[model samples]
Target: MAKGYIEFDYEFCKGCELCIQACPVNTLVLTTKMNKKGYRLVEDAEGKCTGCASCALVCPDAVITVYRQKKAS
Candidate 1:
């Protein structure tokens, strides 16, 4: 299986939770940390992301970026 991870653009996230809801692996969680805009940030709770891009697709702010590693042969 391909390994995956996500990066968040903290400034752009609005704490909408849409991405959290869309994540199939349940990797994302709302954090106590806040950005300059004062919106709560979301983070990868577990390192189990599949790079499916579901969270990115649902993010209205386009804050999430998913990266996948190619499977070894």
Candidate 2:
């Protein structure tokens, strides 16, 4: 089975951990590496999300976008 979710734009991210904490299902994690602006980027933790948009709503940078997979028949 494959997992689905949003992908973050690391370059635009400000290392703000709001997305990581905002996730309802504990799906997101922050990376140690910094972006062009020396900010940490958020990464998905492989199949933990419930496709909720909490993080996207709270993100000031608007770098986060959630993509949900269709249910199998």
Instruction: Report the number of the highest-lDDT candidate.
Output: 1
TM-score of each: 0.92, 0.80
lDDT of 1 by residue, 12-71 (tens): 989999988998878889999999999999988888899999999988889888899987
Clash totals for all models, in order? 0, 1
**CA lDDT of every candidate:** 0.89, 0.78
Instruction: Tell me the deviation in Å of residue 4 in model 2.
Output: 3.5
**Global lDDT of model 2:** 0.78
**Candidate 1 local lDDT, residue 36:** 98
lDDT tens per residue, model 2, 1-73: 3345787777888877888888777878776878888877778865687667788899998987777778788
* Candidate 2 Cα outliers beyond 4 Å, as residue runs: 1-3, 71-73
As for candidate 1, its clashing pairs are: none
